[model samples]
Target: MFGFGKKQDQPQSTIQSEFVEDVAPAAPQVTSVSSASTPSPLMSVSSITLPGAYLHPITKDNGIEYLFINENPMGVPAGKPKERMTGSFGPLPMRTNYDKLLYGTGAAYLTGFFGGGIYGAYRGLQIAQGNSFKIRYNSVLNSIGRHGPRISNSMGVLTMGWALLDNTIYSFRGVSDYYNHISAAFLAGAIFKSTAGVRPALIAGGLMTGVVGSYGLWEQFTSEKKETKIPSLAPAPAA
Candidate 1:
């Protein structure tokens, strides 16, 4: 019999539908391709800061990274809990003015005392001019005994003046910088040489400033702290 009625067409349609379902095409999948010209920068600077020092990031061609320290950044250090008197005094950093006075003066005095003792001994040796061991020993002793106390006293005065000015500035400004040191040196020098005259006092101030500034720069250049490995807390790329 010829299939001519609408009912006869139903079987063909059902078979076509079933065939389509069984052999349906799959959805196209996508593959990602990198289009960037270069990878992300490896030299990432950190925001982590240190008091009284600048953290400068540098990356070497060898894939090593370093944090270079720039001391006495001559500006307010960045951080929270920023408070006055939060700076180093002599050999130590302090949170109060009292410590700056007490410890700073003591440390400076001791340093000067020992330093003067050595200088005095050398001076005594030169003064004796004799090659004799006994003469050298006596000269050294005499020189130290005579000049040591005076040198120590003078050092103490200078240290005290410096500490006073340094502490006052730090307390008022709440920052540690190269200027503070320079100013303190100037004031201390001016005061120490005040009796000499205005010209001598100015000269002394200039000399003191030069000496302090030179030493600070030299320390920065020669110190091992100039370059340090990136701190463990800093962000780093995964291995």
Candidate 2:
């Protein structure tokens, strides 16, 4: 009776097998980090690729700052979305010929001319040393008064005329190319100088043709270079 009551010891392997079989394997001990506990890595990051085509782009309306993008942002193509011209003030949109003429090109020329006048004045003062502060101030004022508004207004008029011609060419051809720039520039010079004389108009037109043609060629070369250049590899995230 005592021997029968005593239990027999099972093999260690059998015990192990029995234990594995008896317990349904616990669901995988999965570990997960909750989203609520951490901020996303992608938030508030700036993009270097496209300025206006990024997650959010600021816009300007009639010289006033407006925090807005296009109404249908997704409709915009990836490569280039019409936002504003580079180096343009206020980041104003240049979608139409009128917009470019009124604000972009004309405004740029005006600003540049005025800035040039100021810079020229400073340079003159340096060249003619020993002038007193009052003299220097007067000289700068005289230079600015003589050059800034006068030259800038003249350039603005010329730019407006050129823009009209360029847009006309673009509309007729249905293609944006250097030819439009060349033709429009020539016409603008010729028309503007036509007031003086026929010879002046021809000479002005010829000079403008050369300048615009050279610029267009340079633009083409640079664009090609940009296309051919290899993109740099992004760095791997830290562990």
Q: In TM-score terms, which candidate is top?
A: 1
| Best lDDT among the predictions, by candidate number | 1
Worst 10 residues of 1 by lDDT: 47-56
Which regions of candidate 2 fall more than 4 Å away from where they truly are? Answer: 1-95, 119-130, 224-239
* TM-score for each model: 0.50, 0.49
Candidate 1 residue-wise lDDT, 1-239, digit = tens: 11111122243311111111121222321111233344344422221111111111121112244444533233444554222333344434454556656665676678778888998898998899689999999999999887777877887788678768876776677565667777888999999999999999999889879977886676557744433111111122222
After superposing candidate 1, which stretches have Cα over 4 Å from the reference? 1-81, 84-93, 129-132, 170-176, 215-239
How close to the true structure is residue 170 of candidate 1, measured as C-alpha lDDT? Answer: 63
How close to the true structure is residue 143 of candidate 2, measured as C-alpha lDDT?
Answer: 69
Residue 232's lDDT in candidate 2: 17
TM match of model 2 to true structure: 0.49
